[model samples]
Target: MPAPTLRLPSGDTWTRAEYEALPDDLPVRVGVVYGELVVKPRPRPIQRRVARRLATRLEDAAPVGWQVDADVDVLLDDDEVEPVELAPDVVVYSSDHDPYERPISADLVTLVVEVVSPFSRRVRPSLYAEAGIRHYWRVETDQTAPAFAIYSYELDDATGLYVATGVHHDRIAVTLPFELDIELKGVREPRRRRRAGR
Candidate 1:
C-alpha cells in the first residue's frame, strides 16, 4: 500500500506560517532554514531516551531565570521570508517565554543540544552559532562502556563558528551555559546494578 500524501503549500520558499500549517499526521520531523524545507525522520526510541533524560539533568541544574526543555521549536532568525527555524534536541532559554508562542525567538536561547545519529551527525552547528547561541552540545551513542559521549562547544563571535570545549564520556562538567556536573550513567543512561556484592 502506498503511504498517504499530504499537500504542501507551493512556492519557491516557505514561510513560518506554511511550516506551521503542515498536516498533524505527517510521520517525519520538519523544519526550515533560509526558507528551505528540511525534513528528518522521527527520533528512534534510544534517541528519545537520551534526549529526554539529558534534558532532565540539565533542567535540575538550570539557574533561577533559565528554563530547559526537550524538542522545542526555536526560531533562529526572524527573516520573514527566510527565517531559520530549528528545534534542538534540548534547549536552555529564558524563563520569560510566552506560553502561546510556538517558535521561541533565537535571542532567548543560550544553549542548544543535539543527539548524534547516522543521518544526524552534521545537522546544524553553524546555524546555531550564526544565531548567537553561545553553548552547544552534541550527544553521541557509545556501543560499550559509558554508553554515550557528549561533545560540548562554545561559539566564537569573531569567527561565527563553534570551538570544541570538552568531550565527556562518563560525566559532563561545564560552566558556560550553567554550572552542571551530571553523571552519564543513571542520569543520561541507565546504571547497571551489580549481580552481587563486589
Candidate 2:
C-alpha cells in the first residue's frame, strides 16, 4: 500500500505555519518548495562531516562582515499563503543579517552550498540558482573511495541558471564573495569513534 498523504488546509499546498507545525518527531529533514513539503532522510555521518568541515573552512576564510553557517532555513519566496523555503547544507550571508529571523531572505545570501546527498543531487542546485543566489557549490562524495568532487557555479543572469565555473577534486581556489582556498582531500571519510567500553 502507498503511504498516506498529509492533509493541509489548502489541500495540496501548505503555508509556512503549517510546515512549521509538523511533528517534532519527524525522522527526516523537511523544507517547503512551492508550498509542497520536501523531505529527505537525515544526513549520514560522512555528509555531516563534509558540511561541518567545509563550513569551518569558509568561515575561517570569509572576509570581515560576512558569515558562514550550516543547516539554516532560507526563504526563497515570501508568499504569505504559500511560501517556498529551503535549508541548504551551508549558507553564506552578510554579518548584518539577523539570526533571529525565521527564514533568512535569499537576497541577503551570497552563496549556498549543498553536499550532494542522494536526494539533493536531483533538486537543490537548480532551485537555488533560480532563486538568484550569486554562487553555489555542490559537493559529491564517492561511495567506495575516500574522495569528493566539488562543482562550483556562478549565476547566469540571462538564463537565471547556474553556469559551471569550476570543478575540483582535491582542492578549490575561487575569488568570489571572497577569496577562498578549500582543501577537499581532507573532507573524504569521517573519523571513526571508539566504542565506549572497548
The candidate that achieves the highest TM-score relative to the unseen native structure: 1
What is the model-wide C-alpha lDDT for candidate 1?
Answer: 0.82
Please write out the lDDT profile of model 1 over residues 1-198, one tens digit for every residue.
Answer: 556475665778887678767665567777888988888778867778899988998899998999888888898888877878888889899988974677888888999889876545675888888889899888887466354688999988889899999999888988888898988886455657888777
lDDT of 2 by residue, 55-81 (tens): 999999999989989998888877856
- Residue 79, candidate 2: C-alpha displacement in angstroms: 1.7
Q: Can you tell me which runs of candidate 2 are displaced by over 4 Å? A: 1-10, 20-27, 144-147, 190-198
Compared with the true structure, model 1 gives a TM-score of 0.86
Model 1 ranges off by over 4 Å: 1-5, 23-25, 142-147, 191-198
Taking all chains together, each candidate's TM-score versus the true structure is 0.86, 0.85
Superpose all Cα atoms of candidate 1 onto the true structure and report the RMSD in Å to 1 decimal.
Answer: 3.6
lDDT of each: 0.82, 0.83
TM-score of 2: 0.85
Model 2, CA-based lDDT: 0.83
Displacement of residue 62 (Cα, Å) in model 2 is: 0.6
